[model samples]
Target: MIHSQVNPDAAEALRGLCIGLTRQALLAFTAIVAMPLAAEAADGPGTTSTTGKTIALSNSYNGNSFRQVMVKDWQNVTAQEIAAKTIKGATVVSANSSVTEQASQIQNMILQGYNGIAVLAASSSALNGVVKSACAQGITVVSFAGIVTASCAWQVNYDWSSYGKQEIEYIAKRLNGHGNILEIRGIAGDSTDKDISDGVHAAMTAYPGLKIVGTVYGQWTSTVAQKEVSGILPSLPQVDAVVTQGGDGYGAAIAFQNSNRKVPIIIMGNRQDELAWWKQEHDKNGYETFAISATPSISQISFWVTQQILAGKTVPKKVIVPLLRVDQTNLDAYLRTIPPGGVANPPYPKDLVVKIIDANTNHSAMPPVPPPAP
Candidate 1:
């Protein structure tokens, strides 16, 4: 048998190459392990994923159509996020315009370990203590529609004062700055009500001839508005026009009708029934007026804002959402989109919410409302 001679130098080279490859492989693996995982990356560098976060809504009131629509919007938006695995879960709890009850609800949410809570406040200041406590626990709080005064809570707000002023301005123009105006206010102690009433009273000073002959709190409910306005109509002179804080215009018109008085220029609050009544009157006699209100879809925006905060994005403490206005020019278009007994609720998808946040960050104007579908 012939024996083959082994090359010791070649053997040493092969062993060295094997060790080098092993070292390189280990280095690559370590680098990868040190990098951020896909699950933790979100929005941009330094941001964290919101996938594991859960959010909740603490609503103050569900008594009116606007509030009902707001709750429905929150459910629809949060449900979509949960189904997409963007958030772990979400829930909504509503109180009947009671500050104490709302505070209790928020306290429960905090104890339940929600990552975020969106509040439709019952009072501007009553819920501040609970809101601060949530913030101290590192939970994000977003207050919308009826905002709170907590410094740590983010607010998605509307220009309620502008809404009120617009109504009075339109009435003054329609009546040529001289009319007996009937004023319809909303919930008495609500921050929104106070803001709008202040704006209305402030704007009324510009036109000395325009006097507010009657005032009634409609509680932003049509039935309540109708009954209250009816009760006050007999004692007052003919009302030339009515300036309203939404959800009460159609009732004011009904009150006038029931009292056998002529219906004047009643500013609508963008409710479906109110729009329908306006359309009927418009068709019959070319009656014209304006409608404006904060869209209930602000709930959707609030949800996205919370999601962004959970994802480690820096958002402003106060984000202003524009009010929805329906004019005689596009009343029919808005009317067609609303349900039989619902408010005008536009959708607020995540992308639009991002734009709104970015705009607020840059101190620019928020995006304008899209025109109604044809």
Candidate 2:
């Protein structure tokens, strides 16, 4: 969290991005308009009043990465608003990718008296129970990232189905519709893998010319993907273009390197942190990969989601942020566009999100009776 307290100094910096820095200020300031006494309390310890505030963030992450950075940014932004005297404090409680552990964490947060909770489900099915229990407590719950269901109170996510369609479309065009393609899936049970693959199959179903040579699951880790690719290459005939979920972009390049093949491989993925390596590797080896941000900078979404909830505004039950394609051509273009507060928001109200989701409801996608391929 860069600034737990709002810095008027931040105004100048935020103005440059034109992200409605003024509007955020205006609305926050307006909250204190009719009631001067509440406004007086804005300067006090600030925790005394929790009228329209206090959100407990329960995130699903195992390590530090873009997602982690984004969460940190969200914390900083929300804290700034609180310090700026916008609303009350929003407390954030984090948990790694364990379903049982995260569920326990949510229970703990509720016991601690948190009013609202933002969660990233470990597994779409596994976390449904957690969401329901949390909602039963009358707490607001928002789920995102690898989470793909519409069951949560609200879900802010990237359109993985669209992301998959676009990447496959790009590969299909590059190969002129006929080539051997390899797919490295993300975390096996995570909603991201299912939605993206669902979109890929939805698109590829029509493109019979493009043959899927070999399929494997990488669990969204570069090391696992590297090993999986090394194993997949020997059994396959040839790889024309490859599409993977995340760091597998680097892994695909490594796979191509291992085989010492001349055939071109295209990697479609997210994660701007890898840009430095991507540039250096491509420049040195002359063979490179490309990617599209599967999910928008997670940091920006957290703040936007938090703000929407706190402002007493109604937001969509589900918000799907789009991704930007990054090849060698425009990699630098998006470099500065990432991190917290990256993309701009669409035309929507502060509370539209609430109307779309009924906090009392519980929804789930029935597990495909047949288990997925491991």
Candidate 3:
């Protein structure tokens, strides 16, 4: 009877072991079946989600609205991409208007193993060494707005020379090829500033009628521009027009208004507040001018180009983003969509960026002629 009981107990224990083994096998089968589906879910359509690229944005200055808007837009776009896992992450480093600090910051980014670096350089040529080092590590570097002179880094910018010439030409025509214009220049020694100034001077020489009566550095900030222009107003001659390198146009206009002088035909940069004021002035006195400036959204172009490069798409060493022009016809439209005191231009369309990548990927050098503005 005792032997019979032992046999029954042993048989029951054997049955329990078999049941546990079966449960473990079922779990293993489920995990194996789910692996591919899980991977597909992690990837977004048309993206190498597995690549997990990381990018850094390095800027030398953050005091102006343009840079502020640029950083914000970049954050918004990259945040979405990060959620989709198209890229692993993004970082922004600001040098507080110092080129040396910016260079060091990028060196750290490279050492941290970032896949790409996007920069609005503080100095056009100062950061070349670090940029080259980053490129040597197989990291992509893309610059925009205020570009770098590093040949290894890709550059994307609006045609500042064209911007200057066109803006001055418009004012020149309004002045009938002759006027004493006040030039509110951007930061002294900035590449963008130099290019725009060159364009303005070129136009002035070609027309032989427009004279730059006074010049002051606006430093690319509205408040600074207003104060500087105001300080210089008392000793200046009759200023019939104001040619500016984007940032100071609105401030320059305000200075004339504050002094009870007739507000001149001031060419405007694409600042939202500036555009709003332009529309109001248009309503009040039929004030008319065109908008041309490096849109802060040009940073988006740099961001996209960096992305394409990280994805193994070959891109041109230099790519040009066109100056965004907002005229009287479209002024109200921009005002309707843009925030009060925000930036004016929209983010670049994706389809256009794709075309740019496809067109320039094979270029061995900059085209002999400047590419037409898109």
TM-score of each: 0.81, 0.67, 0.77
Candidate 2's TM-score reads 0.67
Query: Which residue pairs of candidate 1 clash?
Result: none
The regions of model 3 sitting more than 4 angstroms off are: 1-51, 234-237, 356-374
Summed backbone clashes in each candidate are 0, 11, 0
- CA RMSD per model (angstroms): 12.3, 16.3, 16.9
Collision pairs in model 3: none
lDDT, candidate 3, 93-158, per-residue tens:
888988889999999999999999999898888899889999899888998877888888888876
Error of 1 at 335 (Å): 1.5
Name the candidate, 2 or 3, with the larger TM-score value: 3
Q: Output the number of the lDDT-best candidate.
A: 1
Cα miss at 337, model 3 (Å)? 1.8
lDDT by residue (tens digit), candidate 1, 295-332: 88999999999998888787878888778888888888
lDDT of every model, 2 decimals: 0.86, 0.62, 0.78
Candidate 2 local lDDT, 64-107, one digit each (tens): 56566556656676677678765566666566678888888878
Q: After superposition, how far is residue 360 of candidate 2 from its true place, in Å?
A: 22
Compared with the true structure, model 3 gives a TM-score of 0.77
Predicted structure 1: lDDT: 0.86
